[model samples]
Every structure is written in C-alpha cells, then in structure tokens.
Target: MKLLTCLKQIPDRDTRYEINAAGTGIKTSDLTFEISECDEYSLEESLKLREEHGGEVAILTLGPQRAEKSIRKGLAMGADRAILVRDDEGKVTTPHAVAKVLAEVLKEEEYDLILTGTQSDDWSYAQTGVLLAELLGLPHATIVMEIRADPAQKKVKALREMESGWFQWVELPMPAVLTIQAGISQIRYASLKGIMQAKKKEIRNVELSDLNVDLSSIPEIEVLKVYFPVVEKKAEILQGSTAEVVEQLVEKLKKEAKVL
Candidate 1:
C-alpha cells in the first residue's frame, strides 16, 4: 500500500494579511507561512494508513524551495520520503498545469492509493485532486471520510459525504486518488527524534525545466490580479423589548438583506 499525499504551503491562517500596493497579491514580507490545515489532515491520514498497512508515504509538493519546510514536517510526522517541485519566486501555477506535472512524475511509480486535501487554504479551489485524477484517467472520489483497503481483493472501499446529507459507498480500483475530508482523524505530533531523523531523510528536488516539460508550450490560466478581500463591519441594534427586538431582526433580514 504505497501512498502519495499532496501537500501545500500557505500563509498562516491566523495572521492578518494585506494586499500589496499593486493589488496583484499579498505583501510577501509580512506573510508567515505554514502547512495548510486541510493538507495536514491528508498527510495525517496517509501516515496512519502507512503505519497500519506497513508501506511508504510520500509527500508531493509544488512550490518554491521554502515549501520543503512543510514536507520536512510531513517527514517528521511519518512520511518515508518527499518530492519537491520547486517554483522559484512563488509563481502561480494553474491546477491543470499541476496535474500535468504530477502526471509526469507519477507515471513511473506503482502506487495503490493517492490522496490530497479537500482544497488549498489560500485558493480553496478544490479542483487539483479531482483534476489530477481526470488527467491521469483514474477514478477518484472527493469528500472521503472513511476508507477500507483489501489488498487480497485489490480493491478499496470508501465512504463519501454528499452535500444533500447523504453518504455513498464506493468501490474503486487501485491507484485511485481521494480528496480527504477533515475531522476524519486526529493529527499526531512528531517526536523530537523523528524531527532529527527527518533532517537526514532524502528530499529530491525536481525542476520543471528538467522534466522535459515545456512551460512555454503549456498554456496555463492567467491571473491578472490577486488582492486581499476588503472587509466591512455593520451592526444593527434593536432598542426595544424582547419581542420587538426579534421583530426588528426579522424585518431587517427580510427587507434589508432579503436572506432569511
């Protein structure tokens, strides 16, 4: 049971962010980075699987060289190895482009399962995992909360959550990707010894230029601008008795916002 988990590094969610003067992106100097929360859940799930089934867990991340910090954290948590697709200057790469790069690397590996977070924290697009599966021509399921593997039968059983308050049972073949849901399991802390050992573990850094992939030829989606969201605060104070306050609130919802 070999597993490939996609990890991403994003700004620390707790930090307040500001857009740059050009409004094309956030101010890099003020940004503090960390492993995305959902991706960490994916890594934890993969580590738990490997710990149970006695196989390898690999971290696949595409970002600048700094992204290795997140991968090393994964290694310390129990991943066997890490692969870095370094993009200097932290340039944006389209989901399709990422799928292409992953396809290039994954074509040579024989893995029983692949996993990814439900979505990236910063982008929250939630398209990469399913898109990669589509590009690789493998069947995949999103919002997976549980998985049961049967190596003897060479099949996997998964429970998927639907938005309509329903669950779906799916049986998928080996080498399928799954976008994992949060709250499925708890993430374990890496022991100090594991952290020390992770420093010695091999992390192969692969460049897009070296992969026979032509960026010039790959037509990626263009982002004209990225900006911080403007936030505004408003308060509606109902000054009256209890029932009158409730009535005012209802009127505000029906008339002012029209979203009851």
Candidate 2:
C-alpha cells in the first residue's frame, strides 16, 4: 500500500494579484503560496489510507524552491517522504509538460496508488492527472469522492463524483491513479510533534535535467496575454408609471442587454 500523492503550490487566495509587466502572467514577487486546495484533500486521503493499510505515504511535486514549504507541510501532515522536482525557470507550465516530468520521475518507482487534485488552483486545467495516467499506462478515475483499496487482491474501488450530484463506483487494478475532489475528507493540520518530526524527514530534490526530461519538446498551449478583466457599472432609472417602467425594463433587456 505505498501511496504517492502529487501536490502543487499555488498563490494564496487571499493575496492581492497583479499582472506582470509583460502582461503574460501574475507578478509573484509578493504573493504568498500554499498547498493547492484540492491537493490538500488528496494528501489527507493518502495519509488516511496509509494509516489504515499500514504503509508509507510519499509526496511528489514540481515547482520552484518556494514549493518546498508545501512539501514540508505535507510531510508534517504524515507523509513519510517527498520528492521535489525543482522547476525554477517555470518551463514546465503546461499540463502535458508537467505530466511528462512527473512520469519521468515515477518511471522507476512503484506505488499501489497515485493521487492528485482534480485541478490546480491557479490554472484549473484539470488535465495533469489524466495525462499522467496515460503517460504511465495506468487506469485512472477523476473526481473521486472515496477510495477503498484491497491490497491483498491488488485492486482498488473508488466512488466517483458525477454531474448533478450523482456518483458512480469504479474498480481498477492496483497501481492506478485517482484525481481526488475537494472536501472528500477533512484535512488535518500539522501538530507540533508532527512538524518537529517532519524536520527530520527526507526531501529529495531533483531538477528536470536529473530526470532527462526536455520540456521544450512538449507541445504547449500558448497564452497571448494575462490581464485584469475590465469592469464597468452603470445605472439607469426608469421613470413613469409601473406599466411604463416594466415596458422599459423589457425593452432594455431585449435591446440593451440582449438577454431576453
């Protein structure tokens, strides 16, 4: 029951964001970072599974040096160790590139299950997990609400979330991938003792070169620009009797707003 959970570091939602000078990305100089919301749930789920099944939980992430904070947080939350693929230049910006790098690191390792967030908080692309599964040639389920592993049978049963508040059960062989939905489990905070213990845990840091992954060869979705959305507000007062006002509102809906 070796569980590996992929975590991402993202800008804190409460931080103020500003578009960079090139208008191609956010200015991250002053931004605070944290573990992505759903990834925290994935980490918690991995920890729970390890606690129940008597195995080790590991964390894997690809990010800049600052991402070590998120990795340490996962270790403090009960992950046995971590692997950090340092991407200081941000070359691995696309989902395909990320999946490729992760798959490269995972090629030599074996795990009973791999977990990832349904989507990253910053990009919300929601493609990395599935792409990683494809790259690794493993069965995968997305938006998983629950997981039950039968290690003796080398299989896992997962409760998948569907549209309209529906759910479906899926069974897959061991060594599968699962994209965990947020709120699937309660995320536990790092206790003082856990934090101290995490200080002694191992964090193996590697670079893209170490994995022999060339990100430039990967196809990327181009982003032409990134800017704050324009917001405009206007108010018009309808004058006259109730019927006239209602008629004016209807006319505005059809002509001005065009939502009718």
List, residue by residue over 162-184, the lDDT tens digit for candidate 2.
Answer: 99999999999989999999989
Winning model by lDDT: 2
Q: lDDT scores for all predictions? A: 0.84, 0.93
Off by over 4 Å in 2: 232-260
lDDT tens digits by residue: candidate 1, 1-260:
89899999998888777877877667768677888887898899888787778789989999998888888999999899998988886653777777788878788677888999888888687888998898789999898888887766878888898888898989998778989988768889999999999999989998877775555666677767876557664765688999999999999999998998
* lDDT, residue 53, candidate 1: 81
Candidate 1 runs further than 4 Å off: 216-219, 228-234, 237-260
Q: For model 1, which pairs clash?
A: none
Judged by whole-model lDDT over C-alpha atoms, candidate 1 comes out at 0.84
Candidate 2 least-lDDT 10 residues: 227-236
